[model samples]
Target: MSSPPPLPERVSAVATLDDPVRRSLYELVSQSPVPLGRDAAASTLGLSRSTTAFHLDRLAEVGLLAVEFRRLSGKTGPGAGRPAKLYSRADGEICISVPARQYDLAGELMAAAISESGQSGEPVLDTLARVAAHAGRAIGAASADLSSALTANGFEPRAEDDGGIVLGNCPFHRLAETHTAVVCSLNYQLLCGIADGAGDAAHTIVADPDAGECCVRAVPVPQIPQ
Candidate 1:
């Protein structure tokens, strides 16, 4: 069989457990509610302490494992000896998409928006607006260059004549065309996200559909009436 192409960072981290020993150690560590110590892992896996330590550290290096130092004896000071290194599953998400589509992200946002609206007795549109704003905040926190970020996400932003921005390409072009109502709302949310993420609060997305162009346009906030 042909070797698979190089995996992304998150996938590569999880891939490190292909080694039988390492996989076994990781499984044991993950199944535990508390962090597993090197001594316990070595004893459980019937491997030498040195071997176990080597693989555990490798896992930590790849970010598949989180490390903590604690005294198993529950003692403090010089007499307690050095704290033992313990291993646990790392916190946060790990997703690897080949073409870099964010359908999952959209689905997550949509689901959360729906759920929140249902529980809080708020309008679904209002919930979606809040969710979109929060998603935008997350995007803005990652970078200050909104244009660079938009281009990266396949928006193809163009400078407009009125000192605004217009999108040349729609990343969710197909979906927006087919499900204009739902997808357009979602697309609007995404643009809002990009603007928020870029910390460019001065601009907001407007649904100004033109022939063969994206459905949304980024216009100055002042141009939008309250």
Candidate 2:
């Protein structure tokens, strides 16, 4: 699956809706069963065609809206003229949190765990760890590097002077607070899988929970003499 946009981009995209006109246009397009053309949207919102088109295009530019061209008249190519630009809500999800929470990711992991456990008759927690690691590996493989992968997943990786990596944020903070052991284990296994998939064997993940940070840390792997 494709990763969601980074926090800042998602925030900026969402912030565009702060404008009432844009928000209204978004609502109209999103709520409609079918995609709406500029003329239809303008008529429904009592705005000029040019104004509606501008805001709709703006929303599309920010990925909040999807645009498509279709013949509204349902006529053939002989005199159908140009295909009208229609707008609809983008399929991608847009979620924002103050400190960055990825309940969606957690939920996906747990759901997969449950499904796999039911099929294999394995324990749920064990399945959770396995699935979480699998998900992480996929993420790591797609990312350009370890840090980029971590940052994309909301881990907020920071390099330490000792060549270790510390996570400044926990994507599953609230869940970890309630279920520390399970969540922390999930976090650690996921990071380990990420390291494996990213081909970063130089670092090893460890569970070192601290205040206001991720429970997992990446320490340099000890090298042995040849």
lDDT of each: 0.76, 0.89
Candidate 1 runs further than 4 Å off: 1-8, 151-180, 196-226
For residues 1-226, could you state the per-residue lDDT of candidate 1 as single tens digits? Answer: 0111234665787678789899998889999999999989999989999999999999998888899999999999889899999999988445555444455566677899999999999998788777866775566556557787666555678887676888777756666667778767877876787787677876767888782368888887676556
lDDT of 1 at 91: 84
Report the poorest 10 consecutive residues by lDDT, candidate 2.
203-212
Q: List the residue pairs that clash in candidate 2.
A: none
How would you encode candidate 2's per-residue C-alpha lDDT over 128-198 as one tens digit per residue?
99998898888889888888888888888999878889999999989989999998998888888888778
Candidate 1, TM-score vs. the true structure?
0.68
> Among these predicted structures, which one has the highest lDDT?
2
Query: With candidate 2 superimposed using the best TM-score fit, by how many Å does residue 105's alpha carbon deviate from the native?
Result: 0.8
Q: Which regions of candidate 2 are displaced past 4 Å?
A: none
